[model samples]
Target: MKLLVVFALTLAYASASVLHGFNSLEDDTNVGIIHGHNAAPGQFPYQVQLISPEGLQCGGSLISHRWILTAASCTEHFDNVTVHLGSIRRSAPRVTYIVSKKDIIIHEDFNRYTVSADISLIRIPYVKYSIHIKAVKLPKIKRSYPSYDGCNANITGWGRTSFDSTHEPEILQYAKVGIISIKDCKKKFGKLGKYIWPSLICASIVSAETWEGDTGIPLVELRSSVQIGISSVDSPKPELEYPAIFTRVTSYLKWIKRHTKLPL
Candidate 1:
């Protein structure tokens, strides 16, 4: 029996208006850093910031020189999409890349209501590799990485630090989280468990305040460079600190290979 409470979760969409607010650290002071810490420069080079005229909307990963992996929900509507690369701080120094809507590809099986097949890809022109920007390793198709309890993992994004706060961090932030087995994850939501698609993976977060703008943040396995999941959904009440939902990348290995020319 899923609870009837839904917190006002904000997507990590960073619009030009909100961009100004993120730049103000003073505002962030009171908001409290509920979870996650500042990410080191180039620590997660494959990480990319997805931006629309709306501002910073979602997070994405560079799978190849010309391809980015993100959530289909982020590109639902054809809009001008810009990507920022090689920067830990969104408010300052970095290389930026932009692509057109025609280049965005959402999986054909994508279901908006269920958020199934939530994955999407952005095809950009070939970009030269740099220390701050590189493609992330996808898990081996024949081999599956551990997703058991206490499996090491980390997630990075510029979303709000606290569940109730509207302030997004000016710098990139990352947090270590544990993987929750699907069965255990399902039990957390009771009735809501029915909505949990098998294609999605779940992770345990100390603070579940996932905002709308964090739609496509990458959930990378810490030990190896493998990116295992993409931020997909969260519990209705983020303040309650529920497990975070992600689109399991391993399940779509074939689909990703078919779409992008990654050396998968």
Candidate 2:
């Protein structure tokens, strides 16, 4: 769980660094979330905050009234975790949700190299206050959709904007890209030959130099506004490529519901 890789130009201060981006994976045919202006600098959706006094646990997602999805390795246990939404940076005074995390579900066969099952979900505190905060909606399980091409999508996070660089973004940033079929991504990424899985739909500029810093942090598609992909992984090489990989949400809809104990 030593997930310390990054991308971008502005290097971290004598230390470390990363934004708009897109990536995907869906059993359904077509879906996408385009990049738009961020909510605001002071907005972390549900008053969520990072658990770190400084740089600690990776952030989590609120899928329901009582759950937050994040990396299992990001926490020591569940209770000590912090949930921040609304504000972009981790230190911004977000409306924090303090509670115990439970019902953890790590991909049964998660492998960093392949990213086959590198996903998980859990419940968090139900918000007690009213504001511009809410959990992102997961896609419905029963609906079938068509796989689309050139579907606009967006992703925002403070992940590394460049290779092995540690300069993470202070304000929440975003970028735009589109979804592509595994067949095409394979043609481009065939050299890596190991990490690509049918479960991932890559989102990246087919040809372009990336801005100084941006990677990971899930390139999400707003399929009718519900989040469907967590940025997974993508790269031709640290110096030569900016291909970002994303986890397919539809592939795991069953797993999500089964683990989170929800009716799909």
Task: Give the winner by lDDT.
Answer: 1
Estimated TM-score for each candidate: 0.83, 0.69
User: Model 2 Cα RMSD, Å?
Assistant: 8.3
In model 2, what is the error at residue 186, expressed in angstroms? 0.6
lDDT (Cα, tens digit) per residue for candidate 2, span 1-264: 112333222211111011222233211211112222333643435323335334543444556666665533344333454556656654564466554444455567765533466565545545543455566666788777445456766565544334334354455545556777777676765554344567766666642112222222344465554565665443424434435555677777888887777665
Q: Residue 95, candidate 1: how far off, in angstroms?
A: 2.2
Best by TM-score: 1
Clashes of 1: 17
Q: lDDT (CA) for every model shown?
A: 0.69, 0.48
Off by over 4 Å in 1: 1-34, 143-149, 207-209
What is residue 262's positional error in candidate 2, in angstroms?
3.3
